[model samples]
Every structure is written in C-alpha cells, then in structure tokens.
Target: MKSNLVCRNRETVRINEYIHMPKQLSPAQVEQFWNDGFLFPVDAFDGVQAKKYRNLLEEAERDHPGEIHAEHRNNAHYILKFLDEIAHHPVILDVMEDLLGPDVLLTGTVLFIKEPQTPAFVSWHQDSTYTGIEPKEGITVWVALSEASSESGCMQMIPESHHQGILEHHDRFGENNILTRGQTIEGIEKERAVDVTLKPGQISLHHVRTVHSSTPNRSDDRRIGLALQSFIAASVKQTLGEDYALSVRGQDPFQHFLRARRPQSDYEPEGIAFREAANQRLSDILYHGSELKRDY
Candidate 1:
C-alpha cells in the first residue's frame, strides 16, 4: 500500500523504487476499496483551517445569498487562492497524488452546507455522471468542515456498487431531492446502505462511479463540507459544448463548457441542456460575486 511516487514541478508523477515519501494504504484498506469502491479517514484538515474556510464561506453567503450558481457558489474554482490558509492543506496533496497519480487537475468542487432544519437531501447516484469526462478516472475528496453524523444526515453508500457500473436513476421527491425524471434500475438492493459520519476535518475519498448520497440535516447544527474532485494529469481537455466559468490562475475566466457522455441512457438530454443554460445564467447573475473580493 505504500507508494514510492514523487511529485515534480507541481505535477504529481510516479517514480519506482525512489522511496520518496508518499501516503501509504494498508492491504485491508485496499481490499475494502476493491469491495466498496471508496476510502475514508485518509486525512482530515485541522480545526483552524476548517474554521478559516467556514468563515470565508459565510462571508460569501452573506454577500451572494441565493445569487450563486451551482458551479460558482462557495468559491469552488478559486480555492487555491485561499486553500493553503483555509483547508486541503499540503498534507492532503500526498494522498490525492497517491490515489490519482501525478499530474492532477481539479475538475470539480462543491460545498455541501446543510443548514439546521433544512429538508435538503441528495439522491442516490454516482459522481461520474455529472463530470464531463471519460473512462471514469477521478477522485472525490469529501472534507467535513463540520461534524457529520447519521443523525444529521451523513453520506451513505452501497458497498461494491461501483462494480455495477452505471445504474438507472429514479425520480425522488422531498425537500432537497434528486429529480431523476422517472428512470429505474434493476439488480440492486435497497437494503445495503452504509452511513459515513466523520468528525470535523476528516475526509473520505471515493471512486467517481461509486453510488452515494446524503439525507437532510435534521439536527440543530449545520453540516458543512467541501468536496474537491481531482483527476489524473492526462484528463484535461478543452470543453466543447456549453459555457462555464473556470478560474485558472493568470488566465481569462474559463467560459467554454464541455459535454461528455451521460452515464445512464435514462439521463434527460433536455434536463441537461436546461441545467447548463441555468448555470450560465446564474454565473451572469453573480458575476460580481468574486469582483467584490479584492484579495481572493
């Protein structure tokens, strides 16, 4: 489970027999991964760092409120500007590079903030479906900025569900639920569900195709998390379809969006198109969200 991989030039790369310090995974952990398609307790951020990011998120929320888009809200793309000082400290880079290999590109980021008494709940589905990529090579690092537990609607997954590949998604209704648009899947059990609860700063890593979801926050405390999805260095490609805001350092904002194949045939093409358009529209609405921050 130990890796001799070494990072070079800010890009992660593998070196054989180099014995360079790298994150080590145990045989049992690897086997569990092979069976469950996910890993947990890899490394967690410190409280100070978590609080720093939490404050930043609060500020953003105060400024933008409901104006932020799905992609741009919570400063997802601009994390590096404050990541070192906030969360995802250098300690995480080792495990990330170990799992994703060198030459990594952060493809997606999300902040799951479950406020007290909110009925929001994420539907069961694989992460790869939303990512515009192929071959399903990516890692989702879910860092708990606050305490996460089943009572507060922690994440749950079906062990070894990734091996089943893409499963049909069904429409689910609730407070915050997945509108699967009336799709169904066969050969899967609803009885097998594992809730993943972590203390503040703890993290969980899962394969892109792993089936996962979370329930609403019914507890009094808010459950906040920052998720960063990283892929191998070779996964970068110019977006060919819709337009999205990208925050590459020292470059113009990324306005081009790419469209990749849907993981399930039941995925609604019209819904996808509407989501893309809505994202663009939201970006326009919050165009000044980042402009107000002179230091970000």
Candidate 2:
C-alpha cells in the first residue's frame, strides 16, 4: 500500500513532507516525486553552460570517439573533466542530499546519446534491478545536454511503478536496444507513461526502482543526456563484489566502496587507468550471472 511520499518498496522507504530536508525542490514537487517516483524540469545549468558542456562532449567525441563508446561510456567521469564536474555538480547533489539524506555517494554515470534518425532505443526497465545495490535507496539525476522533447525521445516513466518493488526482467538484447542486456519489463500500458521532457539546462530525478525507457531519437539533432546512474546514501553497499564510488556530500563513515576521484582532464592517462579498473569491477556487478556479456 502507498503512504504519503513513496511506497515502502525494496528500494526506498516512505518520506513524509513534514521531515526537515533541503529546499531545492518545493513541497509539492517532492510530493509528486514520492507519489510518481520521478520529478523533472529541475533547473541546474544555464543555457550557456549547457551548450558549453555539449560542445565539449562533441569536441571530445570528434577527437577521440572510441573512448566514449561501448563500456567506456559507463564512467567517462573518470577521464573527462566535464563529466567529472557534471557528476559532482552541486545543484544535482543538493537535490540528492535533500531526499536521501546528507551523505551521498555517486556510484556511476552513463552518457546517453541518441543519434538523429537512429534506431537506438532503451527498453522499459528499473535502474536498481541489475545494479546489485541494496536498500535501493537512490536517485538517478538525468541532466539534459540538448533538448529532451518527445520528438527527441525523452525518457518515459510509469508513475508509482517502483511500488511494485523489484520486478522480473528478461534480457532480449535486441538490435538497436541501447541497454547492455536489453533488459526489459513486459506488459506496461503505454498510455500510462509520462514523457519527461527537459530543456538543455534542465534535469530530472527518478527513483532507482522506477520503470522507465526511451524511444529512438526522431529529432534532427543528436539527443544527448547524461545520467548520473545513481546517488545513494553512504550507508548503501554493493552485494556483488568490490565497488568504487565518489563521495559527493557529507561524511561517508561506511566506506562501502573504494574511493573514486576526479579526472584531471579528458582522457588523462592516470584517469583512464582508474576508469578501466572501475569499469571492470562495475561490469562484474551489473552483468552477474549473464552469459551474454556486452562490451558496453
């Protein structure tokens, strides 16, 4: 059964409005998030800043395209200064801290790019299903680097789906499917899905267990978005194996994962080495028990 905020599912507990928390989001917005398992249009970057970041990404993509593809996309922050800064952005962290408490650990980041007119699409799935992170108390902050409109195939999520807890998923790994395993949850009513559209500078926050997906980009321009895969409380731990994360806020006395650091610059030698090791560990966690291990 549902309470005031979110359902008492395996991933997250109920959070009431009366509790003392940060004020980045208004009371009503927070209520919507709890009730819907997501919130959007959170202003985090200015237009110029967003454009600049986008430019930076494109520049790197043009310069060293291979580094940003496949599994490398999982943790570009380890070697890309822009991605590092984006992952540690204060505004996004503030929202995370407010909802999940003071201590926040950024587990990973995923750079999503849907090329114009491409068949790339994300199947319906919950973020926490394959993550191996327990307590499921985390939020994904999807920051748009370009316009995220329906035409651009913005994220579509089902309200209160997280209440069902961790549902079963099948790995189809379909061609054009952007997900590693093409992991999906079947039998969702399309009409009930809500399109999370955003401007270049805007961002959306969604519960880890929330069911979400995106269609192929139909817009003329490349659809770009950076997903801060998860920001969890310092108390959270990985059940799979050795893990690493960045301490974004407050104190992390738990030390559940190894310390992750910032990238000195794009494709820095030291940073790339760290990223490779981190990705190898994260890969083991995300793709455990699966025979079909993808490069990305």
Instruction: Using lDDT, give the best candidate's number.
Output: 2
> What residue pairs clash in candidate 2, if any at all?
71-296
- Output the TM-score of candidate 2: 0.94
**lDDT score for residue 67 of model 1:** 32
* Span of ten consecutive residues with least summed lDDT in model 1: 1-10
**What TM-score against the true fold does each predicted structure earn?**
0.67, 0.94
Write model 1 residue lDDT over 1-296, tens digit each, in one string.
01111112113322411335445555455445545767877655677767776676676566755433333433343323343233235555556555544445454456677788788777777775534455554567788878889888888877877765566654332325522221223444657978888877788878777787888898999898777654323444433233333322222233233322221221245434543454454334323222321110
- For 1-296, candidate 2 gives per-residue lDDT tens digits of 34422444323422433456455877677667777889998999899999999999988888887788644578988899888888878888878866777788999999999989888999999999988897776889999999999999999999988766788899998988989899999999889999999999899999998999999999999999999989998988898887889999998999998999788667778988898899899889888999998887
lDDT of 1 at 162: 71
Displacement of the residue 229 alpha carbon in candidate 1, Å: 2.9
